[model samples]
Target: MKKILVVFLVIFAGAVQAQEVLQAGFKLLENGQFAEGAAFFKHYLTTQDATNKTALLCYGRGTGLSGNVTEAKEVFGKLLQRYPGDFEISLNAAEALMWCKEYAEAKRYYEKLLTEKPNDFAANLGYANALASLFEYEKALVFTEKALQIQPSNDNAKLSRKYARLGLADYFVKNQDYHRAAPLLESILSENATDKEALFAKAQLYIQLERYNEAEKIYQQLLQLTHGQTEVYLNLSYLSFLQANKPLAFEYANKAVESTATQPQKYLTARLGRITALGWNGKFKQAFAELDSLDSVFPNNNDLLIKRAGLSIWNKEFAHSVSLFKKSLRNVPSSFDGNLGVADALFAQELDDESKKYVLKTLEYYPNQKDAKDFLAKLALRHAPALTTHNFISSDKGGNASKNYQANVAFDVATALRFNVGYRRREVSNSLENNSANVQTMTAGLRWRVKPFWLITGAINVTKLEKDGAVAPFKTFDIASEFRLNKFQTLELRHNSDVQSFTAGLVGNQLSFKNYIATYNLSTPFKVGVYSQYYYTKNSDGNTRNLLFASLYYDLKATPVVKFGINYQRMTFEKRMSRVYFSPFLFRSYEVFGVSENLNVPKQKFLYQVSVAGGMQRIEDEAYQATYRASLTLGYKPSANIELTAYSLYSNSATSSVVGYSYSETGIKAKWILLKKQQY
Candidate 1:
């Protein structure tokens, strides 16, 4: 019995010694001393052939830490194969694959581990990291939440959750989903209030939503917390610049430069911020000097090259801007910013084809770029007019032969407001009579954005008509508000009113009308809307009209721009008309098709749209009429501040037998865009 007891003790002591060696090896591997740890683990495994799960896991970890990723992966795989239900082996394999950057494979292993141990903190955290690496941020947040739930006190797990949340927030911000990102950033700041990164993100979100006061508050808080950290000061400076607070912007920008640590990134950001502030404050010379200084500091920085290009564009140095943009593209061959900058410079130089090439190149890399899309749309409108021509052939009563000539010009304007103005003019002649009727009008408005969810707008219309010894003038004033109900739904309220007096040929009419309308619009790739309107008239009688309208607009997004929009309106008269009236009086119905494109010019850009619309309206059986109206417009911008527009209108009513008259007009206009109290 004594001899058997001694043998048993010797065997047990040897096994314990092997286990201690394996633990020590794993500890070294964990601390990143991989080669020596791997050697120790190999020796221990050789002496003890039937090593337990812990020793096998340690061996795999050591192999991975020593840069033998293949061997580590195979070791973990064998362990998993032998102990199929072991979460530890599964987690080890997942972590090794993560270090190797095999994010998809790591995610598979982590998910399998979680299936076995639902609350396993390591597995959940590993899964989050894997998903994050793959840019599956929404899914990553789920795993991060599980990890937090399992180990609430684990700092690593908490930090991982925070990062995942931040990733989600950034995704929203990039997609222009400010309303969604704002709350997420707010939650992050509420939890870790001193997190400078989160605070900066929150401030940017506020700025995008146009909550300038809130953004300023958060920026000030960040500056206080960071004691004028370079990033905080730079952001504050940008905010000040946007709000037109030049002195404060300059002060903060200088502070940003002074506070930057001796790091390339810090110095670059500070210098760029100061330069931008100077440019926005109208100190172009100082801004250019700062750009030159930046060039001296970081001669090879592609980011600085891009910034200089942007400054050149702002200063109207188109040739220099193009050169800098092209140079930056050499350093960063796939840079979307560089491509876009080059495109803008080319556009400014009126090299439409060359500019379009760069714009398309940018779209190839960044398909969802809104600025690129808008620029392309504008370009399409610019070149459309020169490609098409029209002629008017007509003969009237009194044995008179009538002929007319018309021309159009189109263009675009850029500011906080983006506008497309078009104009067309006509000249009429006859053997018995000759008169030039000029019809001039303009349609200019912007999608006024106060926030992601709220918008307010004001637009105006002026019309002048010339004919036989009579002048007809019409003007409209409009105010509207739109609210986004969700990603796909919006509600709008609009008030549009027009006052006009007409005297031409035997028709002399004066009318004043006001329309109050509300619309519920839902949009996807296709747009659908239902609207109701109450119109008050102060012309022939003090009457009111209640109208219900529905419209569907579809876009094929194809070349040649195939768009189909149809609207149906039903009118109910509150007071009967003196003239015969038709029931369910179809207020407006039309189908339009056209091709449009933009043309780049030396001083400005042009937008040309040509469409043919035909429809019919009914008042009664005898009063019914078939209507065909051809409208053409040309808008020209010789410079940012100068615009010339011409417009023409020709219509004929079969029932009225009054071959609808043709009128055209042209006007030269100038704008002071940045003037104080100009109400652009």
Candidate 2:
């Protein structure tokens, strides 16, 4: 009995020594001296029993925490095999799987362990982390709460719960459920107001919502964080860009590029932001230079490819843009930027069907994506049926007045082909007897885009005229072809046979004209443009007219486009008939004009333009007379498919056989989409 007691005492002493060694190792691990803890446990294992379950668990954790995850996983896996169903060993094994990034397997193992021990804190927390790693954030959150309920004061469990909440919020943001995302982020901020990840996420959510000012505020808060200065500045630059403050954008981007942040991926992103900001500022050469330099360093990188593609689009290099976007798609076939970039590039090139294909593909990859749906709606508008009405009344100093009303229905009958029909009514009256006329007209038209850059259109008009109780029916037609040489150049040629109805006298005479016109326009990248027009007319009274006009303009701004221009006009008539309409032996005019317009009427709720010009005109060798013209148009779009506009114009330039003439007209117009959606 004495010998047995001594043996048992010896075993007890050895076990106590082993427990002390384990406590020391755990102390090292708790202090984050993982490498030292690993060495301590390893030394203990070398001389002691190698299979002490608690010692093995601590060693595996230390090894994994010290960055030897593969070896740690192997060790824990062997320990699990040797001690099957041992809860601590099983939990360590699962954690090792996570350390090795075997998240799915770890999740499965944790699930099994939880089924066996539903209330085990370690298993619940480990499974929560594994699920979070797998981006199963909602489930991860559930398990995180479970772990928290088990150990309400466990800081590790609390941290895991925090990160799970973050992950779930990010998932919601990615899916565009901003309302759901916002509350979660706010919850995290409520817990720790300076949490960098939560702040950044909230800023991005505001950006997605286009609450730019709020996003700017968040970014400003982020600027106080030391760890991600470059990222903060990069986002600030992007936000500036979104706000249409190009100079501020460039300034922020430059700061981002010059920041001392050393993270490689972040540095790369800052450079890209600088390049994009440069592009926004119209510094294309510098942007391209920077892009090329970066491309040489990171060849075929998807983000670089996308940036280059965007620059290509900005430079009007559509084909090259498409090619670069395709290269990005080849790298990541489901890349949202690649698919959407290709769609936009194709749309810029007027390849609508091709653009639609990629847009649909984008939607396929990201269901219910708002940008894709909006783009699809814009595309649909182009192919949908539409109706329009225009009404105007005019009066001249010669005691002549007229009223005109017109309506049209138009639709794209097929890809690149359109058909339209219209009707018009006009009434003219003057002081002289037998100088009153009324006319009714019907019209049909067709337009076909034979190529992306070329289009042909033709219209036929049937008119019934009545003057002094006499009625005359006549048919007239017009045909035109337009060529878009490039983004900034266009040419149009047109010929028309029409009744001359500028005045009551002309309408009473039933005068007709055959007119041929050519127009060419060229816009430069420097915001300068030249527009020229030439006209030749043959009158039914055996008279001919020739006219030439040209304008040179400079754009002062892009949004709410403002332009100032100088215009010149020269004209001659083969024969002058004073009693008739505008038929001068010689006419010349020069003017300087300024105009401000919001040209994106279809995309916005409000549109407007104001134009004014003052100049001098000479007719038939008379001394030059001061001339002035002004026009204003305002439009309101109540919905996506409807628009209402009102306009007024007044001109004192010579427009009649008399040397000086003045005219004014005012009108209201309405346009509506006939269908709520496109046929396709």
Every model's TM-score? 0.51, 0.89
Candidate 2 residue pairs in backbone clash: none
Error of 1 at 615 (Å): 54
Best by TM-score: 2
lDDT per residue, candidate 2, 617-668, as tens digits?
9988789999999999999987777889999999999853232469889999
The C-alpha RMSD of each candidate to the native structure, in angstroms, is: 21.7, 6.7
lDDT of 1 by residue, 75-169 (tens): 88898789886666667777878767788888887777778887877777888888887778788878878887887787776676677778888
TM-score of 2: 0.89
Scanning candidate 2 in windows of ten residues, the lowest lDDT window is: 1-10
Q: Residue 279: error of model 1 in Å?
A: 3.3
Model 1 alpha-carbon miss at residue 361, Å: 3.2
Mark the regions of model 1 whose C-alpha exceeds 4 Å error after superposition: 1-86, 115-119, 261-265, 282-297, 370-680
